[model samples]
Target: MDRGKKPTTFFANRNNKIYMDLKDIIRENTLRYLPAKSLRRCTSVCREWKLYISTPFFAHNQSNSFHDLSGFFCQSHSSQPSFISLDPIAYGVPDPSLKFLPEPVDIRCSSNGLLCCQGRTGYKAYYICNPVIQQWKKLPKPDANHGCDPALVLVFEPSLLNFVADYKLICAFQSDLDGYEFDIYSSAEGSWRTSGEICFGNRQIVPSTGVHVDGIVYWQSRSTVVAFDLTSERSTLIYSYSSGSLGKVNGKLCSASIQGSKLTIAELSNPYTNTMQMHSKTRAWSVKNVTLNDSVFAGQTDQKSVLFIGGKIVVIRLGSTLISYDTRTNDIKQLATEVDYDPRMIPYVNSLVEV
Candidate 1:
């Protein structure tokens, strides 16, 4: 054996080990940052890679890495439902481009990356879907009639025990009697059950969409704000400002009321209990008034709506035009769009959660 050949063998073994270590590091990062659809296709690569991606720890971190504002699911009476992306760079994948539904459906509400929709035609059917993954499941029909229009809210969270997702749907409708009835559907039970009823002295108007903060859902009525506790299945009323829109800003429930030229924002403090349930008693509301910019109105006489787009940004819309107000910087900017129809915008986050 030659002395020069001995040094060559030593260098070859060292380089081979370094190459194997680099391959392992790349595999770990890919599982963490890849989109859901791309990750699904990666499972076919090899058996060891498939096992690593299938773990619960990887799934939880993958979801957190992809959780952010992706786009909005917008629908109006004049046009079909469409999902418009806000940031395509963060999306990291091609648009899902899902346009058709089994039947004509109305997107009523959204929570935790899930959209709650109902059938437009004869039999009343409900659906829960993740638009990015294009996966959906049809809910079982309720026992009692939901009348012509029913108020509904959906809550969804992905399970850590298994890869399956868990969801709940709550419906509020007018009863034949004087009061209103509430029904709740549970995915764990796979059935719909009736909850307690609340009798408002006069008829109350409930909005189609509600703001879900923490575990409580809030809907505004003519005179009071209705609060529903998801954990306890109980409903209560909080006597805050009426005739205003409800939204969540910086993890607090806020209401924006419009006066002649001033916009008043009231935020509720200590609204929930220690166990994360909504308190029955009314809480204090901290109020702040912001003078309106005349340019925002633009001499429009139509009704306007307010929506909180996370953080300090609040959007006000009259028709097709949208004005966004930043609380931190006191800056105002109009949102631009390419669509022809007036989009009903809401705060949305894109995720890899599959139903």
Candidate 2:
């Protein structure tokens, strides 16, 4: 070795290997914490990084850590939809305009940050999109070609099966006869398949939005509850005295009915039983009553819509005024008032859910 300069001898190869391992660990943690938008841009960084971020496990973990209510998707009278951020402190900027939706589309339903929309004038187009990420996919039209309006439900849960790429879109409509039929579109299958037909006898499937509980979907009819098992592809009708307005309250399937100014909530409960049940015992529903203040019921002649917006907060919409009733503290908060139309507000949480 020369006296003036040091030779090329450095740290051992084992030390360099350890340093690279630490670098990889740090990179993974950093990628996991990044928001969905940034992580999507990072996919083009390198081949290895792209593969890692696209994996189901990585998407699942990122979704679990990044769970938060981004905002509400509001549809105005002009049939144009916009996203209003719920947290003004975090996203105080102007409301984001939705450019992904078609010009004249009907805003149907939303679940787990995904919106299910259909074309107003045609039956060929159906879309599932995430307004936050501006990502959308057009669904293949169902096999049945009917003109009846279909009830739509969108279900997307990233934490299930450690995958964020799976989703289910269900469409139920009245058949030509006096019965109801369903068509389910699965991302795994990439096609729409018709499910079993359910004859309502004399009763009809009262038009209402579907409420998802666990993995099953429930719809309230006149005097019964239609429960669709997404896993088994079966439909069950349970007799219920609910008001045809169904929602999930405190993580349980609940039904709400408004009588005068009193709002009644009933939850379906399954109790432990040791004996063999006869004819598939029906689950019991416990009832709780909450009286709405005069302000909520003032100048409201039309029927009110009730929805549970997670965390014990019940949203009541009567005409143009939107009121939120907190079940925990018994406090009522007015969210918004005087809108262009009756806002179809859905409980939404932003995630990196790929449809």
Candidate 3:
């Protein structure tokens, strides 16, 4: 070691200049195979590299469209969920607050960068809020009635590169055991239509969280996965697991959630295991299992919650610490918590968004 010179100065001097040839090569080669994790790490390597990577020209060429997108998770002690914008890049740490919509009572989203927030009024009234632009659009309710299911889902279709949203709301409700009726609303037409009665499904199993990927709303209904398409105006079945077999997973709903640029479903193995099974999006269910328990997942309820953020899988369980499963290294890392040995705020860990 050179006693006279400091380590920081030595490295900085050695890596100071920007090589145009090297930069061009990296910019070209990375467009086809740039790994998001590597890119983030590279940004911290040096200032010149960070500027090149952060440039709009280079960022546009990245493989995935939504590289750093965050899903907003809201929770509160009262009925109103504590509204906090979270950046999973910071691992559940609070980000800036959203000022566009009035205390959101309900919300649905789209891949084209739009989130529709419905205030306690249900389907009829909504505010289309774009997290990117930080703007809001209040729209009138649809005339048709769809029963009482107020579940909203956003669908992002990649092939079409089009964004669509679906509102699964119930316009009428009847007592007894006949069946609860509801209608699906569309963001394109701004109207509501009857989707017929869902007799086979459980009325009490409406999904609160959903991923809108590839033009379909992937929602978990108690034990089943119901996918509703906004373009086709049709509903299809993706998967239905046995009770306690696997829990829910969240993302913006698109093929990007799938590994290797393919569509896949990521969920827990069981209520007990700390392993997560990612079902590759294919005709034949090709499944890949990743164990995230390396001290990151431990305990009862804290090991089950999982959501796909950017290109990584984030696990947040009750009382457990927040951790992100890095697809780059195939490993899980514990994110810095607000405090040492701090119990995760109830619903706070769940309210993670990467916006």
Predictions in order: lDDT: 0.67, 0.67, 0.42
Model 2 agreement with the true structure over 1-355: per-residue lDDT tens digits: 5678865666577789998897688667777665565666678877878899888677667766665555566665465666545554442112244555664566677776677777766664888876655677888878875344567778877665555467788877776677777788898789988887564555556443577888778777777777778888777776675663677766788777676678888877852222338666554677788877756576668667674445566677766766777677877767677755655565565566665
TM-score of 1: 0.75
Ranking 1 against 2 by TM-score, winner: 1
On lDDT, who's better, 2 or 3?
A: 2
> Ranking by TM-score, best first?
1, 2, 3
Off by over 4 Å in 2: 1-60, 66-70, 76-78, 91-97, 146-148, 160-164, 259-261, 270-283, 292-311
For all predictions, the C-alpha RMSD in Å is 5.8, 7.0, 11.4
Please give the RMSD of candidate 2 to the true structure.
Answer: 7.0
The lowest-lDDT stretch of 10 consecutive residues in candidate 3 is 344-353
Which digits, one per residue and each the tens of the lDDT, describe model 3 over residues 147-237?
3444554432222132223233322333244544335555466666765544344434443445555445555555455555656655554
Q: Model 1, range 301-353, lDDT digits (tens) per residue? A: 75566644445666666556556677788887666444345455545556566
Q: Give the TM-score of candidate 3.
A: 0.52
